[model samples]
Target: MKAIREARGISLRRLAKDIGRDPGFLSRVEDDKQGAGPGTLHLYASYLDVPLAAITHKEIPRDQERPGSPHGDDADPPPDGDQGSC
Candidate 1:
């Protein structure tokens, strides 16, 4: 997540503001000291123009979050023991 943000030349402050979150909160999320909820992840995906899987590393079931969105089953699941490292 941090890498993608940096590679896109987006500052932490800018991302936080765009996502409607505090910079400190986003900083903690980037550092792995905190977890972003599904709604927050959605915000990130929407703001970054990426799929939820890109922000979560796992596919959200078709019937779960995105409904008719393109990010279901087709996403590659994370490796063994992986946990939201996107």
Candidate 2:
């Protein structure tokens, strides 16, 4: 999560504001001390301009799928299909 945030160059405070959450709360989420709700996850994905799947999907082992490739099922699609545009 933090990786994605950094990749997007979004600060915790700015991300929190974009998500309508508190910076401290977002900080906790980033540090893995807190779990974000589905809504919050959606917001994070939207604010980062990345597909929610990129954030929520679990990486499967190569052995779990074809050789040399990780595969996993897509998470339930982002709640509203359209997370609010910035």
Candidate 3:
């Protein structure tokens, strides 16, 4: 994500503000330290003009967290063998 964003000459601050997110939050998303919510990912896809999947290949499946459902940021991390990490 960072690579693509940088390649497109978009600054993290600019993209974060445009997509209504904090730059630190976007940084974590790029680094895979946090899982982005679906809505947040959609905003990124729209702002970056890229396919959603391109940025969400490792996102939690919608079936696991229905759209609009809340995800606790501090929830227990996925198991070591789980499909969580990108």
Please tell me which predicted candidate would have the highest lDDT against the true structure: 3
lDDT of residue 22 for candidate 2: 97
- Which whole-number lDDT from 0 to 100 does residue 69 have in model 3? 38
lDDT agreement of model 3 with the native: 0.76
Which rank order by lDDT, best down to worst? 3, 1, 2
Which digits, one per residue and each the tens of the lDDT, describe model 1 over residues 1-86? 66556646789999988878999998898778899898888898788777777766543334343332346555666679778556
Give per-residue CA lDDT, model 2, range 50-82, as digits (tens): 677766645422222333222334434556848
Candidate 3: 10-residue stretch with minimal lDDT: 60-69
| Per-candidate RMSD, Å | 11.4, 16.2, 13.1
lDDT per residue (tens digit) for residues 1-86 in model 3: 76557656899999998888999999998999998888999899888777887677655433334333345344566667788556
Go through the candidates in order and give the clash count of each: 0, 0, 0
Q: Each candidate: what lDDT?
A: 0.72, 0.69, 0.76
Better of 2 and 3 by TM-score: 3
- How far residue 12's Cα lies from its native spot in candidate 3, in Å, is 0.4
